[model samples]
Target: MNGIPKGRHSGASKAECRPFLSSTERDVIRLVHEPGFDRWLDQIKATGGCENPVYLAGYTTVQRAETGEILRHYSTENEPGGRMPVRCRNRRERRCAPCSYLHAGDTYQIVRAGLSGGKGVHDSVQHHPRVLVTLTAPGFGPVHRATDSAEVCRPRRNGGLCPHGLPVGCPHRHPADSSAPGRPLCPACYDYVGHVLWHALAGRLWARFCDGLKRCLASMAGIPRSRLGEQLRLSFAKVAEYQKRGAVHFHAVIRADGPDGPNAAPPPWIDTDFLENAVHSSAATGYVQAPFSSATGERKIVWGEQIDVHPIRGEHFTGEIVTPDAVAAYISKYITKSVSDAGGLDQRVHTYEEIAYAPVNPHIRALMATCWRLGALPEFESLRLRPWAHTLGYRGHALTKSRRYSTTYGELRDVRARYASESIGASDTLTDAAWRYVGSGHTPGEEEIARAVSHELRVARESYRERVTDE
Candidate 1:
């Protein structure tokens, strides 16, 4: 500070004032003397307290719209670390837990809004038709599984053995935690090729099923198939969940809407009951024929016989209890999930050797091998099995919804950004920014604080939700 008059700083520098700071803030106080620490903190805070931030070297200037005058200017040139950091914004819990937690919350809000009517969707949509449907993959092989506690896995007559020399039946009443479900009863008898192909084409199967459902609804309504497009539209949100048995199952929230969207109601003739029947009938008959393979033979894929449909009742519904809230939560919960169960890598495979060394269980390795094996055949190249071997052959969006089904993730993020800016009273006419990648992550001490902040945010959100529920 100048002797004439103390400026922004304490007359005695922060170094002299540091002893008064609390224990928790000491780590931060250490940086008080550093010119850019405060600005770095501002940027980190802007990321909503990111765990692992991205580093950048940048400068930005905002100008007034009415006049060619600078409104605000920022640069990372003076930072103690010589770089600015931004949030990673990753949604995978494994990569960034804090960001993923935030994503899961956003997903919950999006689904709930779609279900109960919010986020620009019409409130009358509560009266519109909706159903929760679960479609399962057909059994690729009779793997040794304890279907229930009461049923012994593949009970055999006098402990007989199969031609492969493995036991034909398992006598153990496998517990819920037992790994038997994902393993083939006899490896030789297992249809690994079919399993991988099914995973690859699961999305297509659902698409076909949707088309079939529309046609069924049209037939029931006594309209021409071509006219169905003009009369009614189908909207849905679906999530793919992996079963303990290494197969993927789909849970979908299907909504019927007019061609215009959620605001326009479906033709009165099409109710939830008709939708349910169509779902069951279409799932039963719909099929996708995979490329003919001499080894596994031509396979026609269809939904497993086990299909569950629940009527999605809205806030005003009293006729039948539909767990729309629970349905929304279930689907949202899986948006952050990946195929860890199938033993495939979360990232893509680079070479055959990487797949061989993947941390997957023995069963998953076999499935991956099958994927690689089939990916090589000239006929199966269209399926792109080799690159997706880490996914056990499945390739589709983890979460997908029809454009009219609900608001988009992008819109949600934009709203969040606007709210954050408004809270700080930020405005600009013209903004120019120059940025360069520098580095990422944090020192040990900074990481500890970031984790504590992340935990507090989680607890605070939970407490707020509880209070609202009580109200």
Candidate 2:
């Protein structure tokens, strides 16, 4: 009944003349006619129209601890289908756009708190030395890349060929969004094994880099390594992003605090330039040796040559320095991105056949296959390349931070939850809650309706933002 063809074609037979409706349309009608439709709609709105909301069946009760009086009570017993909807809370945009949008906002706040302090962090952190750092993976082979300044992809005055007989240079100037940029010039010439192994050890390399930075800082201060922590503490928040060439790189906000933590001021010797120098030195010198395999031998993992360290500035600061807001927004943007952004899959692959059948370009497929092949080796079992084949062997989380860097995601969510719901009691409440997952996802028509609701909510937010900007 909901926009489905109510009448058949003019030239059709008796069966064709019957009113036709899809299962989704019938379900929509049934849903709207139910007594709990309004409550269901309200529940969806509460979840911000989550694409795949989980259904929960249970209740919560709060009572005054000393008075023995009930302060609040809530239950899903009367909800639609005897359950209430809650957001799936997936951070990947490809998985749930609504939840990811919310996650991105939280990420922005978390990163911003580190730079400019809020959400339980002391404001004194704003004065600390902060820098935006970019760490990249070493190149595995010659791959086409988008170039700025109108430069050719790989111009060569003397045309030459690789061992595989493919031209070693390209004269094309690819656009920033072109798919050809990430593809290797010659697939046969690419070091697929080396690329996969590097991805597997990227997390270890980052750890080594952090340790190297601490040593470098100690060396510059002319102090023993053991005593460095007594004078300065390095705090950072980082996000991993996949490059178009399928390599994972990191963007981080590094801050220098005193020995105590963010509330304490950094030492007089510490500054943006000081941190930048240490970052450059450590990135250059730091290395991690991959687990020795008889076939691959010992491979050393190190940061790429192009390390970008930009000093982070306050809002009023000018010139080329990146502002705190810019840094926060930059890191937040990457947290929602998955390996799929690099032409890879977000889901895990179980077998070689699954990797072969995955809907990905040849380069990504090759990387996955390489991960699977390498994962079988006893020496590389810890890397779990097979399980993470979908991500091209990169196993680290999308975002990570030092303990002193900023507020956490859990804290942010708790704040949001408290804001959404009224306080149960001042400090004298005893709360008990019981919940069980009932189901997830939506019927076809419900999916359509939820998407519409999500779009409308997004539009309302944008309109409100524009109005605020205008004022």
Candidate 3:
């Protein structure tokens, strides 16, 4: 009677007359009728409506260290399904928009603190000389380019053809969103090997460039390289961004702090011009050697010719001068992007068949194939190109900073976590915490509800911000 219609069918059997329900519909009905449905919804709200919330079973107890008095206690024994939900905290927007939003906000704070000064950094540091530096990769071959204006891509006086009989010049204009921007003029002419190899060596090249910069600064100050730290400290926050061509570029906020650190002022001699000159000198000369491989030969890695250095000003709007807020916003805009933004896969491709079936453009597919083929070589094993074929062999975190740059992501998260719950406020406290992963993800109906919750929360935040600005 529960599943079948109330009225009896004249000729049909009981099973044939039973009401039909999809798996997701049945799940939704069961979940709604559960005793802890409301409590479970509250847990979802706490996670900012995470699309892939991780389930955890755990308990925490806080007690006074001296008197052994219990201060606070939390357990998941009474939670829905004996578990709790937590944010996945993925930085890639394509995978988790809510987590990426939080990450981008944290990144903005980190960059802004190093420039305008906040959080743990002293506000006086705003007067320090800081610059936003952009380092690019050298060209491997000619590719179609997008333009903001009505300008032809790679215009040539004479219509020429490559060795493969493909047109060498692109007389057609491409808008910013056109799919043809990143494709090579001739696939055979493009240096796919060099592209992936450069991606593999990008992190090392950045390290070399930073070292060279410090040396250059020391040389300018007429001091020994080892003693340079005694007078001036270089602190930086950098983020990597993938271009339309799938190559990575680095954007860094480099600040010259006093030897004592951010709270102290830099030496009077260290000005914007001094920093700019050092950056140019280091980028022009710094180089790193790739691991020797008989298949690809030894390659020297260096920053490309297109280097941009902009002095960060304290003023918000000065027309020509870049501002701290502007730099922070610019860096935050790209912090959440992954290879998927450039028409590539977000997950690893373990097999050639996976690469073949991946939903990526032809240009990106070729780069992934190149990484896979090169990863088989004995000498290239250290680079681990195969595991990272999805990212075109790029190795390293998308965001990195010096020890003294600013407050860390971990510290920011800790502060948020504490504020979200009741604070113990005890100077001396003993805490015991144990947690374990139970499971992750949601059923189809749960996913639908989570997406709606996420959207509603996002809108509320934007509306609240608008009201505050108006006030």
Candidate 4:
């Protein structure tokens, strides 16, 4: 008899009143007691079955096709511990540290491969003329910044106050990490349109910049635009990062490679000087126009005045240059970040209530409202701004690498699978497998137990590793 209320089971004997396991657990136990436990366990492990075991209601077998020889068979009963272990690819740091670490490591390796050349890329390609460039958004308004010179922070020329009674200028020297950094001195004057439009058109602006660079190179080489691709090519990997002021900026590794890609040498004429000129020309002229405002009839968008293009060089050049390693590390650091890193909203805005209650600054709030309003318009249906309101209407990839930059995501997965196979001395033969989302998540009690166990195991492992290293 299962456990029941005192009133309901008053007549049942104590022996019959024993509490039984849950139906789900009983189903799992039944499967574990089946004849094909070994094969079932193997399949479960391969498919990454679960953190908390799931019961299966299926069967499997292997037999000779022609002779019908019962070559092999397995059932759940043969499993050692009555359960299968599996890998969990949880991305949230709060959920699984191991998986998050794995993801970060893959990102680092991918970025590093593009920089120094590894995996499939040729190591010699690291010597190519390259640059680590950062493009910043224009000043929307006067924002507080740390300065060393006495004149830098002097808001008032001769000590005065604004109409609002705020100090005309700050005379004190501020530290770089001061809390007042990035706060607007006069929030009313901020050019919010210029800021939002810059973020929205960042990807398009990059495309135009690349085109300008190619044209600049072609003009210098005295080659036709159509023949430019045949002579040389520009390759790059870039990441978008948000500044403290909630504006998007870019960090890119720009490389000049042959048209044949990383495996081939560039044309003799395409040297560092040529690459530098192309970068400057592109940055100076790259611009994108915003959508025509119904109210204003016409409007224009453009890149900010602030642009940086640093030359990347190997030790042989002996000149000022950004290194490949530094570039890779810098880009990789922002791979896991979101708009939230820059004091912006993290979740989508679905209703007016959510937007009104959002804790972001007034400028960011205005952007969200704009995205929400535009999202409802039939003319802006394609932008899908509402679904991405939290991101301020930008729907481009956060980080993009060129084809020849490094090993691909698919290659990385394959390499990992091959390593696992090698460790088990398994033949590199494909196996057919199928799985479905039967269920997910842990029960409240089970979740608590699992968290505790995971924490204790991590602490023990860390202690052991530290002791070993100290020796």
Candidate 5:
């Protein structure tokens, strides 16, 4: 039945009457009439369709070639919207909550799989010695800190003060997120070069640390250096986190598997204690020499004095243990974080004007300025500081794992895709398809409806899961 004012449209057809109704009403009617439309709508709601939904133009079909039978048919070009269904980009918090939540879940699963071994790793790895270690940067200068101790903020000896006339120290109990935190106690004394150099050489330092670990293991095992690879192997996954001070710290899950990886076990001689000692020794001694400065004719680099090594003891361990779930969650949480989270810039420095307005700690700003200045010199052109300004002149990987550490991201994605395909009973045969970005995001009205639906779905899911757990 067509609904239109008789005077407005004397003989309007069903298609012609569609234009008169509100877009919302049209969408609602289209959704109601199409078979399986509810399922697609549910998917959209699950994705939390937001303002600026990405529209996809595509086609799909399934046919029996022998009998020329059209078993299934799907084409976006002929759909009501003249395009395939839209999906939320599923970015992290700033982008799309629905997609972000989905991404976080996948990340959690991926990390968990690596730790406990489910996707492809052998289950026996649960018993293998593991550790969750956090390595922090050494003090460049005294910065603000968060503490509950009453002693915080007490006056320094002799009522000492920095050259800048600021108090030499602060004793006030500062909360973790306090603005004062991470500010240098003595800006002049703070080694900006050392801080930047440390970031630049972080990856190399890790490589050196690994090498030292292997050497230490070999010596302890009484095996020839050449045979160390044949005897035992160390595997690890580490994520670098930017501290409030703009310094990078590392959280890593270290495992000792056979040279061949999860399938094989470490030699009996290699114990938790041995691994711990190796890690400590490496952290203490490992260093990466910085490149010499032609202008200054000097070479300088140093490792931080502080290092932490914790044993990843499961239920079998005697002391307090770090659970696999905790490790996975911690690593995954940091994986999505950026330097901006730690009061650093998220984008590269493009112009001098941009540098002035960059929202970063004064110390980080100084470091960036130094990098930019250095980058201008013909001698230091290779550093590419402007492009890496967001990272504070350090261009190392934010997250890195050993080859044999755990299941890979690629493997996890493939498994998930296969499961999704199998759930729908999709054929194994590959089909070539073309898709182009015609547009992105939803209309304001659609976004409002989507947000409401998504919130309700999230609440419902949470309640359901809680009930199941309680039972």
Candidate 6:
């Protein structure tokens, strides 16, 4: 490794091998000889030396709300550097790994809380009718897909051709890792315009599915649709994940609770069988029509024919009921993978031509081109499809939950703030603070130290967890 270009290094320690260092690293090392070095290092270490931390110049003063007496005062003037740094807090892994890890942890806690009831939910809610369901997009056209066995994708008994004189069948078995699977058999025959528009409206499609389910439940119970909400409330925590075909689908955990929330027992009419049927019916029959455009008339969208609903049972961590744990783990894994696996650019495209030069797969590029093209139409202006071209016209959060599903992200962060600092408290408390953003990120040498510190902390944490588990 040392013989390779850029990988060469002296056998001595970095401290002994390096004859020169950047200004930032030198400044940080000098703080070791300064007074109160322990306190300064502790503050910086608290953030795990985040990959892209925000630097701020600020002063905060705490005062008694009633008497107006100062309780405490703090400023960045006394710190090692004349600025305080906070984590960049981006959830996308490509943007910031440390903050993305934090976001994933919070998401796991949120989902687990709803599943087994904790963190602001009643434990008894675990007994409620709960199940995980998947909603996939309908097929736009036949594409290359490898089956489990010797079957080929779109094998034609008699060979056929598309409108553009391209073959309609694929004979070769495409490897999963190969880009051939997602590419259309004939690109000219693919409904790229509808694909982009469907994703642009996938969220609304989910909403219509939910509404349709409610209507189905009311029909099943022999009650009016309007009166169903009074007896039972449906709550869900869903995340959108991209399929290999560069389309988005939803995996959601749905629960039927009482009128109040997870704390209350659902109406007597609610049961696992009934809920399952409702979900299936909704996905099958629910439909929404998009507006007509210049090149095409109105199009109706429906969930794909395939749907899966698995009933959740028993406790999360105990014997006889390991499904909940698997569900929670699956969600965490999906959220992390979605950060980079969507096959689209993590950043937005500023122009239509940018899609052509984007470092992405052809599937995503085609979808992006469709977005930019359709977005230019005056009738589609309200969809804002152009801005989300990076996402292939999808503009929805990776994670979404019902209002009463569980605690919120804001609440989770507030709890952490209260635990980490004494400054956080009731909402009514008065806080006088002013901060200006100085900059973000470290010099090359400074980043080297930060990465080392982060690695050490991770190793320490894993070791501690192993010991605790063994005990």
Best by TM-score: 2
Least accurate stretch of 10 residues (summed lDDT) in model 2?
Answer: 1-10
Query: For model 5, how does the per-residue alpha-carbon lDDT over 1-471 read when each residue is reduced to its tens digit?
Result: 122112233355548777686665555544446675556455565355443457777765655555556555556665446654454544335556665565566667666766788877888887777777777767677777766656574446667777778877675777776777777777887877667767766777788888988888888888887898886777888888888888888888888887788778888888778888888887887777766776535534445677777776555455655678877877778766777777777667787777777876677788787777666766556667667766877787656777776676577667766675434334533334567767766554456456656676678779998999899
List ranges where model 5 is wrong by over 4 Å. Answer: 1-43, 46-53, 61-73, 78-80, 84-92, 294-300, 316-320, 422-430, 442-450
Q: After superposition, how far is residue 319 of candidate 1 from its true place, in Å?
A: 14
Task: Please tell me which model should have the higher lDDT, number 3 or number 5.
Answer: 3
Show where candidate 3 strays beyond 4 Å. 1-30, 316-321, 425-427
Model 2: per-residue Cα lDDT over 382-441, one tens digit each: 999999999999999988999988889999898888998886656889888999998999
Clashing residue pairs for model 4: 34-77, 35-75, 36-74, 36-75, 36-76, 37-75, 37-76, 155-168, 155-169, 156-169
lDDT of each: 0.78, 0.87, 0.87, 0.65, 0.69, 0.79
Per-residue lDDT over 1-471 for candidate 4, one digit per residue giving the tens place of the 0 to 100 score: 121112333455434644554444434444445676446545433533334544432224545555555544544334543333444654334345444444555766777776688888888777777777788777777677777655465556687655666665776666656655666665555555556556667778888988988989889988987898886777788878877777788888888878888766778888777887888888888787766667324545566787777777744334554577666666777765768765567667779779878987775677777777766766556557788778876766767877777776578877987676434222432233333333444444333334444555456668998999899
Pairs clashing within candidate 6: none
Candidate 1 per-residue C-alpha lDDT over 1-471 given as tens digits, one digit per residue, 9 for 90 to 100: 111112233355556756764544455445444577556656665665688898898898877776768867878777767777778977767767778777877787777767778999887777778898899988877677756767887887798777888887888777767767668888887888878889988989999999999889989999999999787888888888877667889989898888788888788799989999999999999999998878768788878888998888643445445666777788888877778734456888878898788888788888888999899998888889998888888888878888888788889998987775533234637778999998788765456556655666667788999999999
Give candidate 4's TM-score: 0.72
RMSD each, Å = 6.7, 3.7, 5.2, 8.5, 6.5, 4.4
Model 1 TM = 0.86
Candidate 3 CA-lDDT value: 0.87
Looking at model 4, which ten-residue stretch has the lowest summed lDDT? 1-10
Winner by lDDT between candidate 4 and candidate 3: 3
Error of 1 at 215 (Å): 0.7
Model 3: pairs clashing at backbone N, Cα or C within 3 Å = none
Clashing pairs in 2: none
Candidate 6 lands at a TM-score of 0.87
All candidates' TM-scores?
0.86, 0.93, 0.91, 0.72, 0.82, 0.87
Q: Which portions of model 4 show Cα errors greater than 4 Å?
A: 1-100, 146-154, 158-180, 315-321, 374-382, 422-430, 438-471
| lDDT value, candidate 4, whole model | 0.65
